[model samples]
Target: MPEPATEEGNRILSLWQGSWLAALIVGVLVWGLLIWAIVAYRRKEGDGMPEQTRYNVPLEILYTVAPLLMILALFYFTQRDQTILTKVDDSSSHSVNVVGWRWSWAFNYEEEGVYDVGTPGEPPVLWLPVDEKVTFELTSPDVIHSFWIPAFLMKMDVVPGRNNKFAVTPNTEGVFMGKCAELCGVDHSRMLFDVKVVTRAEFDAHIADLKERGQIGKLDSGRSEVAGVS
Candidate 1:
C-alpha cells in the first residue's frame, strides 16, 4: 500500500490494519480449535464406542452466535468508516470538476475559474491546497472511467450522464499520481494524471498561471470546445 497522503487515507489505513488484526485473531482461534479437536478426540485402541451425545446446546449456540457477532462488528466498523469517507458537506474550501474523457482527464478549478486539460501524451496536473478540504465532482463524457489516487486511498467511478463526488483533505505536500482505474477505450492505459499538493499560496499561483495561459473558463464536458485540449 502507498503511504497515505490525506487524513481520510490515514483513517482508511487504520481501518484496514484493524480489520487484518481481527482476521488474524479469528484465524488463530479457528486453527487452534481444529488442531485441539483432532488431537483430543482421536480414537483410542482400547476404547469401544464412545458415549454419543445427540447435541451440545451451549456449543451449538456459541458457534452460531459467535460468528453472527463477529459479522455484525465487522459490518459496524466498515459502515462507520465508509460513511466518514463518503460524507460531503459545505465545509470544502475548493471544489474541482473532474471530467474524464476517452483517453485523458480535465480539471476545472471551479473556485478559481480556470481549467487544465490533458491529452494522451501529456497528462494534466491537479493542483490541490494542502490541509484544505477539496470536493471533487466526477463526470465522464464517454464510457465509464474511475478517478483514482492510490496515495489518497480513494477512488470514485465517473459515469456518463451521472455525477459522483467525494471530499478529501490532503495533509501532506508533495506530488502524487492519479489515473483512470477503469478500462475505457483504446488509450485507457494512457488515461493518467498527477496530483500536486502545495501550500495555499502556491496553489493560488498555479491557478493564476493557468489564467495567464488563457485557460480561464471551465472546460467541463458539458461545454462545447473544451479549451486547452489538443
Candidate 2:
C-alpha cells in the first residue's frame, strides 16, 4: 500500500494491518488443528473400523460460537473505525467541491471562490493545506464515478444526483496521484488527477492565482460549464 499522508489514512492503515494479523492467527490455528486431526485419527493396519460417532454437539457448538465471536469482534472494530472516518463535523477550515465527470475532475475551492478543472489531455491538480482539515463534497454530473486517492486510503463514489462528503487533514506536504477507481466510460483510464499538499501560505497563494486568472465561481454541472472533454 502507498504511504498514508493523512492522520485518518494512518488510522485506516492500522485497521487493515490489524485485520490481516487476525486473519493469519485464525488461519494458523485452523490449519494446525486440521493437521493434528488427520495424523491422530489415521487408520492403523489392524484397525477394523474407526469409532463411528453420529455427532459431537460440544464440538459443533464450539465451532459455531467461535466463528460468531470472531465476526462480532471484527465488526466492532470495523464499525468504530468507519464511524470515525466518515464523521463530518463543521470544524473544517476549508471546503472543496469535487466534481467528477465523464473523464476528468473539477475542483471548486468554495472558500476561495475559484475552481480548477482538468481535461483528458491535462489532469487537474488539487491543492490542500497541510495539517488543516478540508471537507470535500463529491458529486458527478453524468455517470457514476469514484474519487480515489490511494495515499489518503479512502475512496467515495460520486453518484449522479447524490452528493457524498468527507473530510481529511493532510499531515504531509507533497504531491500524490489520484484517479477514478470506477470504470466510468471509454476514457476511464484518462480519468486521473494530482494532489498537492502544501503549506497554508502556498495554498492561499494558489487560490489567489486562480482568482487572478479569472477562474472565479464554482465550476459544476449545475452552476457553471465543466471544462473538460465530455
Candidate 3:
C-alpha cells in the first residue's frame, strides 16, 4: 500500500520547487542576454576592432539588482513560512513527551501515562494519532541526541538538563523511521526509533484499555488490573 501525504513534506517540496523556479528563470534570462550580447557584437576573424564600451551604469545596476531582488523576495517567503510553521495554533491539540536515551526512545502521553516502548531488547516505537497535531517536549536522559522524521520534515535536538519542544501534525498513517540526527556516542547509528501514526479511534481504544489494565498513568499504578483506581 502507498503511504499517506504529510503537510510538512508537501510544504517542503513546494518551497523547494518555488525557490528554484525563480532562480532558474533568472539564470536562464541572464545567460540568454549574455549570449545575445556576444552574438550581436561578434567580430569577424579579420574585422576591425570590435565595438567595446565600459560598463554602462544602468546595465550594471540592472544586472546586480535583478539577482538581489530575487534573493530578497525568496528570503521574505522563507521567513514567512518559518514563522507560520512555528506559531502555535489556539485549537486543542494533544501533547506527547518523547525522551531520548542511550540507544532508545521513550514516549509519554499525559492522558495515557508512560510505558516501555519498542521491543523488550529493541529500540522503542513512537505511537501517535493520525491527523492530530502533537506538541513533543523533548529531553535526554543521558547524552544529547536529535529527533528526526524525514517524511514529516520534523527534526529537533534533544538536550540533557533542558527541554526542547517541536510540533508535528502527521496526516500520514504508517511507520516512519526516525533516528538521532546528532552524533552522541559510538553507537549513534544504532539509535533508531519508529513512529506509528494511527487513527484517532484506535488511539482512544488503546488508551482506554491501557487505563483499565493500569498499564498507563501513574495514578492508576496501585489499582488492580481490572478495577478503577481507589
- Local distance difference test values of all predictions, in order: 0.90, 0.91, 0.71
CA RMSD of each candidate after superposition = 2.6, 2.0, 6.5
TM-score per candidate, in order?
0.89, 0.95, 0.75
Off by over 4 Å in 3: 1-4, 34-43, 48-52, 89-92, 117-121, 141-144, 208-230
Model 1 lDDT tens row, 94-168: 999999988888898898898998888889899999999999999887789999999999999999999899999
1-230 in candidate 2: lDDT tens per residue? 78899989988998899999999999999999999999998888998977789999999999999999999999999999999999999989989999998779999998889999888788999999999999999988889999999999999999999989999999999999999999998999999999999999999899999989998988776223843533
Model 3 C-alpha lDDT per residue in residues 44-128, reported as the tens digit of each score: 6889876688779997998799879887999988998777656555442777777776666666786567443442247666778
RMSD in angstroms between candidate 1 and the native structure over all alpha carbons? 2.6
Return the lDDT, model 2, position 118: 88
What ranking emerges by TM-score with the best candidate at the front? 2, 1, 3
Candidate 1 stretches greater than 4 Å from native: 44-55, 222-224, 227-230
**In model 2, what lDDT does residue 172 have?**
95
Candidate 3 to truth, TM: 0.75
Task: Point out the higher-scoring one by TM-score: 2 or 3.
Answer: 2
- Tell me how candidate 2 scores on lDDT: 0.91
Q: TM-score of predicted model 1?
A: 0.89
- In candidate 2, how many Å is residue 45 off? 1.9
